[model samples]
Target: MTPRLSNQMEKFYKFPDPPELAVQLRTYSVQRWPTMNHEWRKNKLASILRMKARRLASYWYAEESLSPRVDELEAILALLKLPEEVIERENLNELQALKERVARLEALLAQAGALDLGEQVDGGS
Candidate 1:
């Protein structure tokens, strides 16, 4: 399989399987399944799953639409995964060094009378 597909499979495996998820959902719901009719139970389950999918889609995609098809929801969740890449660690040391260098250069320019202190330095010392 392609690397991207492999990575997606790896991510998908990290989450619980559909059956386990369904069981968990069942436990989470307050519905009394034994008293409810079969057809109504099935509809309720489908409704719960779709509601969950819409919530997840809103969180992950930042946009919500009318209900997506089951296959579309599954594809979106299984393939796309969470946005773990949104945040990246910046090189703080490098940034600090650059800031210090700029400060020093600014100081030198001020000393040489090349830089005016008349509201030009907005970042007041």
Candidate 2:
């Protein structure tokens, strides 16, 4: 067998095949599961959005500060069409606003569930 196929076979061999009835029962259970409630859905969506926004802001800041001067200048000139300092200030302000929005969402989520912001549902610290 080719190395790739051999590797895949090895991975597949790690788990025993389930009985057909077991598989059917698992599938049925999943299909019968109820949709999440509004508060749970909102909290999940807010968590995802906040994480994405923070990651994007971190990437933008890292690229702005860590790239070579020539590359940075070219990027600023080609993309921003404004002074670097102005762009940096604008980006910082936007990041700050995003953080504040996330904080507000967290507070709302906590209040909706009647849970403290620092508390976890599973009782983990």
Winning model by lDDT: 1
Question: Could you give candidate 1's per-residue lDDT for residues 1-125 as a string of tens digits?
Answer: 99998986664554454545445444323233445554454455455445454454332333334333455346434433424332112234545788999999988778656556545555565
Flag regions of model 2 displaced more than 4 Å: 1-80, 115-125
- Across residues 1-125, which tens digit of lDDT does each residue of candidate 2 receive? 89998986665343323343224323322332235453343344334334343332332334334322333233322432345576568657967998999999988877857855345654664
TM for candidate 2 is 0.29
Worst 10 residues of 1 by lDDT: 82-91
Model 1 / residue 117 / CA error / Å = 94
Alpha carbon deviation, residue 16, candidate 1 (Å): 1.0
Query: What lDDT would each prediction earn against the true structure?
Result: 0.48, 0.44
Q: Highest TM-score: which candidate?
A: 1
Candidate 2 CA-lDDT value: 0.44
The per-residue C-alpha lDDT of model 1 at residue 111 equals 69
**How accurate locally is residue 37 in candidate 1, as Cα lDDT from 0 to 100?**
59
